[model samples]
Target chain A: MPDHPFLLEAKGLSRHFGNNIAVNDVSFSIKQGEVLGFLGPNGAGKSTTMKMLSGNLAPDKGQILINGIDLLDKPAEAKACIGYLPETPPLYKEQTVSEFLRFCAKLNNIPKKQRITAVDNAIERCGLSDVSQRLIGHLSKGFQQRVGIAQAIIHEPAVVILDEPTSGLDPIQIREIRQLIREIANQHSVILSTHILPEVDMLCDRVQIISEGQLLFIDTIETLHEYMQSSALLLRFDTEISVQQLNAIDHILQSERLADNTYRVTFAPQHDPTQAILSKSLVEQWQLTMLMPEKHSMEDVFMKILREER
Target chain B: MLTISQNELQRLFLSPLAWIILALSQLLLAYLFLTHMDYFNALQGKMSAIPGAPGVTELIAMPLLSNTGMICLLITPLLTMRTIAEERRNENLPLLISAPISIYKIVIGKFIGTLSFFLCLIVMTLLMVMSITLGSSLDWLQVLSGTLGLVLLVASFSVIGIYLSSLFKQPTVAAISSFALLFLLWIIDWASTNAAEFTLLSWLSLLRHFQPMVQGQMNSQDVAYFLIIIFAFLLLTIRRLDRERLD
Candidate 1:
């Protein structure tokens, strides 16, 4: 990660609304071609941090530098390197997609000569070529979201921040947008905020889970999995499995029933509990249907972090 | 700034409201011009007996310009109200704020944008006066002077409209506020006379300065008065947008 000079650096960023702290001393940076995913529950300051990063909202205390240019000291120069799409896409309903993107290109300071090609490239990239001539108000939500992203990248900014880019899209549209984000990630440093956990797994190189105005975890997805993988198994049977009988097995430290026919069995971290459980199940003929090493989902990790904070 | 201005102007033309305002105002003003022309024709017999009779320049063209100025006061808010207010309502103001542009650039860009559209309306009315070139000699200097005054006045109106639009999210609120404020500035001269020793308020009235320009008089103080109002409102808008960014 240190191999490439950082494209963005945020230090000790904090913001407040009245007496309530919205973001507190949070700091993170993105290297070139890195897509950082911001995950959080409702009211977790994800959008607040995004606003500060994009220069739409000033932090009460912090410094943001884009390519070593101080954002506060030289906002215009710094903003030139950043492109942002907020939770609500900023679009003129009366304007056609092509016209809106062209205007955005001009606003972002693309050379007027290159504006046509830049706008065309954005339309093609966001998969809006078919709807380029359509009025934005008349387009579907998915197309509007694509247009939002198209504007963000029309300038080819070094840093792109997208807040809930796929929030209201249908599943097919979400997949297309996820693919588009992946394509964008190949070239530009991206910071994406979303409630969809799998999107982080699919698109982001690293994940930052924020809760209650504080960053809870900033680590690679691989590392998150490694850190969260416990020696636990989620077992389900066609018929009921008594908890008392299940607890009798050796190496099984505890067994918590999850459903009428399912239990979450945990063993010592060092032991391979799978074999013992399989052998016992075979002996008892408990009509085993499902017994797999539990892959703790992103939701479990997020819940654990939030529970620990509380 | 130019880009923002052009986009705003382009948007103004695209909306049906601009066309309606332009077409309706022109039709109404033309009707007024013809009626005045008829009245002047009837008074032709009495004019020859007088030493210096009022001509078409005074009877028709001058009033046409003045009436068009008044129409601008009434119609400008509809055009300027959405420049920033609609952007805020549609959640597009952040696009401008986060762009590599200054708040001054935004305020000035919007001013120029609205001014350009106002210029079109003014030119359309000027053509009506240009048609007078057929029958009588026209005072080009007075027309230029009046046009300059109208420019300053419309620019002042646009600056105030942009400022109010920034403060309010709803375009309706912005439009109503601009109308009320412009009307107050227009009528302050009458209000000042009813009050005690507040004659200075007349100096603040746009009419007090505008009337002199319409009559072919160009004074530096009147120009300065309009310039000051335009500058103050534009500066206030920049400050408001800047503070909102921080907030």
Candidate 2:
């Protein structure tokens, strides 16, 4: 509504429960059509932040602007532009999927005439067309989660915030939900909070890493991939190589023998020693069975970021 | 607000609890109505010997309406306990919380939803009263005044039930506390020795104000009392939910 590039922006948000600070001075923004993955561990304040952003929980201090409207000042108007799904899908298990979504459409103040189409669109988008007439209690957990998503997007707000949308689903369901989220990102900006790290890489255009209520990292997924690009190499030789021989290469930080004739070689980020190692191995007659740069799994980068924060 | 009220009412009917409460209350009240009618018919000759004797309206309808108050106090908690507490327990509250609506609208919507269901029960009781008009000449003013008193009494009880429901997460706990509080309010005036005193406790008693209207007397003070009680408790419920969001 205003002249802002970000559809949703949270600034210096903080919430406290007694002596515990649940979310501490966090700030970030997401542009339209971008999926901002919120990565965090349990109790890292991801849910708390999501609650504050969606206007469900008011922060002790901070401002949340949805489409440049202040959330605390004009909550109903600002919240009209935002959609939220908490950690547990907030649903009435007694109602059928279409019925629940129609109720949501009413809650969001959609015009009566358009409500049917809005509900139908949400049902179709969430892959819930098959079971729209079934009671939510009778559906599987996966279907219920889809109903949660449907209720969130029923009014087609500018921002859709889903907290742990895929936490308890099986692999197949998880993949299906991810695909659905990817489809949602085509029209609305999405802020998805999940502890699962790979989900961020798979669906997010940008990522924010939070740990202990602190924003440790906020960057594009490419930069996160850069973090995953470890400066380590794995090598296997026909004959066992001495640690001293591996250390002799320039820019090699450290080297460790993992098994017979196998070594994990750490090197500096600016200098890769693969070419040096190959020439040296040839001169020393160390028959190279394998040579490849070691890549850090998402878990490694996640843990490394968390460890550095501590 | 209408949207929330409609959804809440639909959800209430969807559960077996609402239908059970409706059927059980009608059964008990109908039985009470028949017994009172039989007693009035048996005493008809003895009452005619006395000058200006009470008729079916005085003998049957007033007492039946008074007893309806007691039934309402007992059953309203059961009906209203699930209004907010179950939503909180099942984590369904966030859907309402995150919507683009004020907390006041939500509280009032829940109150209206529960009040509408109770209105149906009162209507059923009025139907029973209307049946007596077929056999004898009935005092329409007395019956109407009694119905007004019953409506006000049930309305206040519903407000209390909804307020307690918002305060607790477990529906059973909410139901129990609501019954305890309503019963205390219902009989609090008994502690007063004389009606002439008109102490604060008696003024606050729910039954004290409801009694005059049941006797075919309509006073502005009695109606104001019930209205004030409903407003105050609804305000308390709105405040509770606002505080819950901050918490």
Candidate 3:
């Protein structure tokens, strides 16, 4: 198992409801110790894909292998290695956190002797130890989400699939859950589906952008960062300069003056206008006081990809 | 499957609805048991004057068993309404569906969990029926046959409730639908009294099949009818759950 490269592998997954395709020919894999961010807009089939991978819903066409066991052919064995938390946490509110976790441990087929240990471990990992004895319905939304996570990891499944785990929580709860997810990534491959772009940036080692039931992009976070790098620079001159003076710089594709001395300049992707602008500013006595690259936000990268895919 | 059933039982006990229903039904049945015993006591001397009269088994135990069967029909839908429907409504079914167990196990586990509660009710009724042994000589064979009939009838009821519960997301809807279906099957024999072609319907009536066994007949045909009902509904529930995953 250590020699195997992928802990979870899904191939050509496709699912359709009546005439509408929810997921179409999507394939991806996650290696051990890797956190995969499933990014998409609403109704982009991220949840549907998660359902297929977790064995909750069957794919019309595909194969999912968890720890090298075929999921469709041998579901119970394969599912033993997968932990899933759907969009809404599947929780029985009548039970306390410990009781619910114990049930999950049993459902995962953990040995009866080890069930208590498993439940305790999950509670500790998800930061639910303090509330373990509290009723799930009485807990806050954040605590309920934590209980959801606790159940998913109770058996230490190799692949943990969580769909929007941090949705509908305050900032502190989101931070705490994100930290817990980071801890989980140390031992298990995590597939986190969320529309929150920053969540993906902060937690995922790799990213997959899905749209319209198709995977539009798949690569490391570094590649996604590369897409976030825009070919634009913000320059603030101490002296008020004319438009013609600002137009003298080389590699400047477009230029716009916001105030009397502020100029926003666009350049080609491979061109570096910073050195050219500095020299030009000195020669023209533009008295350049500020020069900074305009970085595209994660939202920009996400929207751009989605737009291009369309 | 055992884990799922245990969890289901735990859930059932956690809700106040189950406890309230359990307490009320038991109280009502106990009241009925006392009333039946009192009537039997009042008629005991008068019955001894007859040549061949019905004893405690026929006079008290069979009626109690039959009434318990009727109570089972009335209460089982409420008990089983949340078995699968609440899971769907609360969106907790994914927890089971995503687990390593098969759908067959989930359906069977829910059936067993809910049926076990009904079994408790039967046990309570039997205890009441067995109380007759302290004061009067009871016909043990007749009591055994009647208890068997009650168990089979309740099992059929529970499985149908489980099946109906699987079909809807709202527990109330599941309960109402199950009650309607059970009531229809319970009284289908009433129609056969007036129509000749309705004999088949009478044979399908759950009440008709239950009556012979409670009378100590123990006919294979009656037993098979209950067994077939239980088996068919269970299979349908399993199929519905499997189709749920597919859909």
Better of 2 and 3 by DockQ: 3
The parts of candidate 1 lying over 4 Å away from their true place are A1-4, A227-230, A235-250, A256-264, A278-289, B192-198
Tens digit per residue, CA lDDT, model 1, B139-225: 888888988988898898888888999899999999999999999888889966564353788888888888889888999999999
Q: Considering summed lDDT, which 10 consecutive residues are worst modelled in model 3 chain B?
A: B191-200
A111: Cα error in model 2, Å: 0.4
C-alpha lDDT of all candidate models, in order? 0.88, 0.91, 0.90
Question: Which candidate should be chosen as best, given DockQ against the real structure?
Answer: 3
Which residue pairs does candidate 1 place in steric collision? none
The prediction achieving the highest TM-score against the true structure is 3
**What is the TM-score of each predicted model, taking all chains together?**
0.94, 0.95, 0.96
DockQ, model 3, C-alpha based: 0.85
Residue A279 displacement (Å), model 1: 5.2
Q: Which candidate is the best by lDDT?
A: 2
Tens-digit per-residue lDDT, B88-162, candidate 3: 999999999999999999999998898888887888888888888888888898889999999999999999999
